[model samples]
Target: MNAPPLELLAARGTDLLVRVAAVACAARELPQLAEELAGLVVRCAEELTFCDVYVLDDDGRVLEASNRPPVPLGDADVGWVAAHGCARPHADGRGVAIPVRCDGATIAVVDVRSAGRCRDEDVALATALAGLFAPVLSSCRRLRAAKEREHAAERFAERAVEVQEAERSRLSREIHDGIAQRLAGLGFHLSAAERALPDDLPETAQQIALARRLCDLAAAETRAAIGGLRPPVLDDLGLSAALATLAREATAARLHVSVTVSGELEDALPDHVQTALYRIAQEAVGNCVRHASATCVDLLLEHDRDRVRLTVADDGVGFSIQDVFAPGRRPDSYGLRGMAERAELLGGRVSVTSRPGVGTTVEAVVPVPASRGRREAGGPG
Candidate 1:
């Protein structure tokens, strides 16, 4: 057959491209975008004077067919094209499978079969269209993937919170019921030993004294673990009271801890914010004890007209915050990340400032919703 008019082919290809581009632009609003894209492919295939045209997924499954029977696009027909990895025509027939790549990964394929012997120009045109179509679809795919990942992460975090709560409950029960009772029993045993033993039984008295010391140590560990799980004071009192209690606990342990609060704080703050702030302070103080080894720690809370701020600072050894979250690092380093996550969930942000010699400070700022501010201003102090 005489060479097809190049200008006619070009014009036809451009018209089809314009239509497909319009469809792709509308894909975001289209409820059935895949079917719409498939329909566009079939329409373009028939209008372009080809024996047959088909669109395939990245896996080579036929997505849509034009001017050809609905035959499956299998590895047999398109695998060679993918392996050869170019927009070249098949040696045996007038067909080619052009790869459709978007964001540097193949997402689909465009296959053209022609009785007129497909030319390099035809292959080039098809390649261009495929490239355009790929990016549009790829963007959609990426958006969908991102939403899925976010939902999955949210579910995972919820599950994690549930597990953590369960663990805390179990620890609370064990300490309150088991360890505390054992310590009381041990103290009674020590008292009985002191009373029953005669003046000659000094060696037995020393053994009883040692047992009492061991019991005290175990009781301290149990309390520490239970406090780490869930601070009873935070539940019994409001945030200010809890902070005061924490400071006193640390001071009793020979760690100089001071807590300061400014502005009026009422009992109406949301539960999550209260919990997040409490947990943040808890984590920060724990880190100060474990990592800082500092003699002095400061906990500060400021609630005002617009926002609430909490700060935990320690004068001790600090670390490189950048390396703190690196993979394969110590699990204890997750303290900062966890604190940040909690603050973010409360629509707040957390910042960590540290230097090797100076010290470390963790601060969180959370905006109180307008209603809370209004209520706080009007309510009695």
Candidate 2:
């Protein structure tokens, strides 16, 4: 039989590549990508029996084969091609082992081997294939690097939050158990001294009474400071009871507060998630009492199958969220920013809706990690 014309063979090859390009584009994992790449080599370079794709991995800096068993970097001809970025029977595109360099380092290498030697056309095709896939390999590495950085950032944020909570708890304990108690004891002593003092020395009696009043004020302030730190109720009774207590304590001069809890939230979420959601709720409620100038505030906490949602709405004079969180605009309050940061730390998000005359609503939704997913597993069967 006559060999097929070069033009027809090239056309068929081009058509096959076009179809495979779609598959390569859709592939998200390296294994699938390796299969597609292997298909390309098998279809185009039929004379070659071995095709290996080695890609740099995130953990180890060394290049590892993405398809088959590991191919040592110092194997043979492939090693030469990889180290020098040049191929034997040199073509315009270079060699099969020519390293695909990204960021001044070799990120990937494609090795095509035959039993005998690399034909001139075969070497050229292999070079062309590696050159074509170079950008893809580079892009994958970049994307993987970006994801790694993002994950590292998240871990740092989470650890920071945990450390912060521990410090907050320690500080809260000191203020409540130490300073508050001391102030209370001093107030008692002042009261007893006042009773012992003679009425004739009215000026001295007035001084003792005034001292007692100041002691009471200091005790109140100390309690407020303890409340600002991590709430003890979160550890004692969990988030639901804490929010209820928060609502009770949040009632301002004219502000009426209420809390409605839904779903089986007990032991459903990890500690970090619980802490984050509680912080968000605390900020929102504090903002309402301090700044909202509204009368009625509602706090809702819900724990669904795989997530927890919280809503805080108030019938208060609202302000523009854009104006509050805009760049270069540092308002007196960091409450809104704090809420957003807390939610985002746990792979969650917060949304705020407000109109001048209507009201302000803050809603936060947080995902439950799969590892801590006992709610669904132990739910009512």
Candidate 3:
């Protein structure tokens, strides 16, 4: 026959003391916690003269032991405790199984096996032990839950950064290609008309010449502003074409640069991938011209079946990537931070390797989802 439910033991005095002591010890031992939870078992073995006792984790693995052979508790035992999270009593061959409660939930079963049948006093002690175990278990549960919440918060923050970068990219494209191009064209026409004006129309010609010069200056300024927003060729001509255009511009500006594309890029890439590569190259070139006192810069674009990559390297003055992102250290350029954030958002990664004299190379790697098929024709504009 089975033993009684755990409630019967709860009604007695000795059981209550064991239960209270267990909880008190758990609280006191915390943060500096150790194994070996013993209250009822100690009391019963010494004062009450009970048989044997053990403590267990929620998994039912024997955790604490006193005057007992180590219990054989495994996944199945824990499964049983998990399935029935309540206190009860059972009488087997040598002892009785009493439910162990921690934080009001039954996590383990305490088996008190005397040489013979156990007394009512022993059952009471076991019930008291369950009560003590409850609060300690509750504390552990709370700690684990808090850790999970923190991890979730970190992920959310990273996602927010990604969204902001995407918005900037979109805005940059609009300002650079649309409005700036129109302004540049208007300036070009104005200059052309001024040059065609009759020299004999002196006063009229002078006014026209000044107007033309103003237009020319305005056009140059607009183009410069547009370049900061986003490179126009990147949006209109795709990555390869865009890099070539940038190279030409750099050459015109007396900066020596070479661009090379490898791999069979016959597979048209996604627009965002193209944009990221273009921006990275654009930023690298800009940095080379401004910060790196180098004579030459190289831009390379490569695409394979699974991923797309861009590399920009210059033989100029290089700064350490570690120092730039270290705590309390400020970046020499905001563009570097922006570039890193962009790659992370796309489930990709960016690495900048540089030394004092060794030139800087910014590499961006982004994975292309297999579900998205490549365009059979030329790359996106």
Candidate 4:
């Protein structure tokens, strides 16, 4: 057969380069790129009878093939070209295999076959096309690696939150069942001893009374510890009731706290979501009383069809939110961080808005499960 003119060959090569560049630009992922490269090689090289594109992993294992009846990884030629990082022509003059390299390392292999002898120009063209694809493949590899790392970090954060919650629950149970029970028993024993005392022994009676008073104090302390670890109201009455109880307690502490429910929340939310919201509210209210020196705080719970929103606002001196959350500015903002982390685990967000001399508002919004129906709107209480 007569060889094509130099001009025709040059034009064909330019067209092939343009098509390959187009494929590279349009491909958003590795699989699509491999398929397009295979098709381009076959279409551009009219003399070739067969073409295949193979993507390889870092270990030279085949990850994907772009041809039907794909070439098997067990093929000796494929392995040889990949391992050696060089092109190889078949001894029978029927095909040529080329290794694609990126950053001085072999990343993939291309194999093309012809019915007759393969031309030198055809082999060169195949090698050049593979080179063009290297950078795209490299970029894809890095993107995949970054995504895997992000997923791993998310899993770690979730596990950390779960561990913290489990520990809190365990501590709460121990305090309620062990320490609280023992204190109650001691109080009863002291009462019985006081009753058993002789009428003439007035001093002994006073001593018994003092001992009973101490027991009462110890019991109260134990109850507080259990509540601090995990509020029983949250599990018993749900988020709104729990927040109302929190507000009452704050009020008792000389802070004017009010609870408002804006929508019907009769439907139960997921246990985790409720617990997270309650804890967030608890943290927000505690911050207002302790740090903000706020005299008045408002707790709001609003429910909609798809999400639930909780906001705690205080009218008191506020500080810079950015400075508090910035790195190394306030390491003691663990309470705020904990609140944010808890909300995040529930696929929710916690936002704090504040300015110096102005009041602060902490808000958390979390999605409701689809199975839970929306409640009717009602006047705030």
Candidate topping TM-score:
2
Cα lDDT tens digits for candidate 3, 103-156: 455544555556555666655665555455556645654653454464354355
The sequence of per-residue lDDT tens digits that candidate 1 reaches over residues 222-277 is 77788867777767787888888878877766788888988874435554466668
User: Each model's TM-score, in the order given?
Assistant: 0.50, 0.67, 0.45, 0.64
Candidate number with greatest lDDT = 4
Q: Candidate 3: what lDDT?
A: 0.62
> lDDT of each structure?
0.67, 0.72, 0.62, 0.76
Tell me how far the alpha carbon of residue 313 in candidate 3 is from the true structure, in angstroms, after superposition.
1.0
Q: How are the candidates ranked when ordered by lDDT, highest leading?
A: 4, 2, 1, 3
True lDDT of residue 322, candidate 1? 71
Question: Candidate 1: where are CA atoms >4 Å away?
Answer: 1-170, 197-204, 264-267, 304-307, 367-381
Query: What would the per-residue lDDT of candidate 2 be over residues 116-212, giving only the tens digit for each residue?
Result: 6666666556556666666677777666676557556656766888998989989999888889999999999999999899879999998998999
Stretches > 4 Å off in candidate 2: 1-26, 35-51, 57-61, 66-83, 88-106, 112-132, 191-210, 235-241, 251-254, 260-274, 301-310, 319-331, 337-357, 363-381
Q: What is the C-alpha RMSD, rounded to one decimal, of candidate 2?
A: 7.0
User: Which has the higher TM-score value, candidate number 2 or candidate number 3?
Assistant: 2
Per-candidate alpha-carbon RMSD to the true structure: 11.7, 7.0, 15.0, 8.6
* Candidate 1 C-alpha error for residue 309, in Å: 2.1
Can you give the lDDT of residue 308 in candidate 3?
A: 84
